[model samples]
Target: MTDRIEKIVRDRVGEEPVCLFAYDLDRLAEHVRAVVDSLPARCRMFYAMKANSADPLLRALAPLVAGFEVASGGELDKARAVDAEAPVIFGGPAKTLAEIERALRRDVTRLHAESALELHRISEAATRLGRTVEVLLRVNLAGPFPSATLAMAGRPTQFGISEQDLPAAVAAARSLPGLRLTGFHLHSLSNNLSAEAHLELLAHYGRTVAGWEREFGLRCEVVNVGGGIGVNYADLDAQFDWASFSRGLPAVLDEFPAGVREVDFECGRYLVAACGVYAAEVLDVKRNHGVDYALVRGGTHQFRLPSSWQHSHPFTVLEVDEWTAPVPRPELREASVTVVGELCTPKDVLAREVPVERLRVGDVLVFHHAGAYGWEISHHDFLSHPHPEHVFHADAS
Candidate 1:
């Protein structure tokens, strides 16, 4: 893992617990190309810009993806600034009129209405702007599937319109002036591990949309499956099966009724997660009661993915044996350690009970699968800790 990211961190940053993120642009491009080339031409790929709106990252992905899926005005601006021509889709549960107006004025390609009222707001915004706007109804499925780590479907969530309210919402959207229901947004999974489950979810979406078309005589162009593609931080071996998924889409599309020309996968984590790694300097190593703990200079304030997801994040110890300290620090040969941050609470744990060959004070730990939610979603202002440094690496190719 360090082979791909270590030198960039070590050379650019020294001992300060710099929450560094390094991207292999070439690998990222290759992965995006593979996903794009493998999938059917009818399927459109959009990067969920919320994952990591880093300018360089956005610029790199713009050429590869069909568009950018943005939830807020800032994301919309970032997406447009990086690549002015790339289509952007604006959607969220609660969108202020200002946001709606901005999206309309900026000429966003689509607006995904999460609630009935939002449709009216979009209509009003578009009407006031005197422009036609396309919209997709974000549907929250009302049942269960192979379980996900975090669920956005099969329950009462603030994400989308429940199936029961779909008819009224559809009527409302259709009746609203300046609005066109061109598609449906069925995004439920949050960091899903199973490709089978993801495909199953997609199949369910296709079938449900087909049923909608049959029952309500609705015609749509795209089904935006908002990004929740999981990154396996616990075990590197286990990953979302992109190959099988790309292979299975044709059959899945067969389930949908005719007229749906485009299927958009707003993938954020799957595309960018592997490209980043977060490193922090170890300040102390000791035993807390019966548990071994390695305290770092930074805590969840820098990288909150582990705590937010309630999973033991995976990491590697980059032995920074160049200890210039006058006092001798305790060093371990081969032992299990729970790496904690410098936070006041115990909840700052990053990786719990992980096996490491050597860990000592001054050594740095590099957390993998951190590209998605590391800096963007973390509570960096918790203790006024310095924010992580951003580094974009070009492929040697």
Candidate 2:
């Protein structure tokens, strides 16, 4: 871990007093390339820009990925700015007519129609533009995921069309002249690491697509199995089982007919989570109610995962003096204390009951695995704190 941190510090020698997110562009590109290379000939990868929309990160991934899956018009613009050649696939519940028109004008590869109403809207937009729009019907597969962080794919989730509503939605889609249903889309939930869960999802989707093809007399040209590859934050030694994931998928694909159909994966967190680290500086230390507190300059405003996800980050102290270790500070000797940020909110606690060697001003506190939705989703300009800075690193190749 120290070796990795040292490599990042060495790469950014001239940069000053700025929050650095240790992003290994080469490693990120290699991860994408590996996935693309190993996947079957029909497989296609679309990077979900909602995970991290930093231009540098997108630019690094643009050359390696097949396309971009955007949830909003802003993300579409970011994808276009980075790589215009990469096809864009729009997916969201609240897509406006303007956004649909923009997607039609840009000639996106595919649009994921979420609802029956959205299907009609797309048809209307396509008629106005006088062009046929290719689309995939997003299906909701009812199942249990490991993480209970959110109610995804269940009742009250605004993600995709339910299995029962598929017939009516398909009928509506078929009624439109300019809309062509190309495939099916299904995303189970987030933070699911079990290979069995993934295999089950694929198997269910495969059979469902086969049934849809037979009923509608339309061959399914594409099957997009959404991505939720979990990251190992608590145990960095544990690596994700890509082999099991790849091996389990073929059985499901075998259910489909012997035709050239594209297998698409919209991956966001898995590609970017391991590649980023959030660095902050300690501002002050004090005692309150017989407990010592470490007040860091940075807070939930800069890194929002602690508050947003109701989770704790793996925190480490950096750039400490070896000689100062012998004479422990009063704060360090006291009982475990909460690490608060400069934010005004009482809930701005970064970590509670964190045992540290010493808490002092100018000490750097590092948060691991913060690359995914860390600064990308958590940042706000409130309280006048500057936005977090990003640093990109490339190997010597």
Query: TM-score of each candidate?
Result: 0.96, 0.90
Winner by lDDT: 1
Local accuracy of candidate 2 as per-residue lDDT tens digits, 112-194:
99999899899999999999998999877666444634445755588889878988998888788799888888776776666
Model 1 whole-model lDDT (C-alpha atoms):
0.84
lDDT of 1 by residue, 1-397 (tens): 5465788767754545555667777777888888888988788888988789999888888889998999999999898788777799887789999999999988899999999989999999899989889999998888786677777878877899998999999998888999988989998878888887878888888888988987787787888877777888878888989899888888988877678888888988889888788888788889978888999877788888889988888888888757666898887667899999988898999989998898888788888878888888888899787776778877653
At residue 265, give the lDDT of candidate 1: 86
Clash pairs detected, candidate 1: none
Highest TM-score against the true fold, candidate: 1
State the local distance difference test value for candidate 2. Answer: 0.76
- For model 2, the stretches where C-alpha displacement exceeds 4 angstroms are 1-18, 144-148, 322-337
lDDT agreement with native, every candidate = 0.84, 0.76
Q: Backbone clashes per model, in order?
A: 0, 0
Candidate 2: deviation at residue 187, Å?
A: 1.1
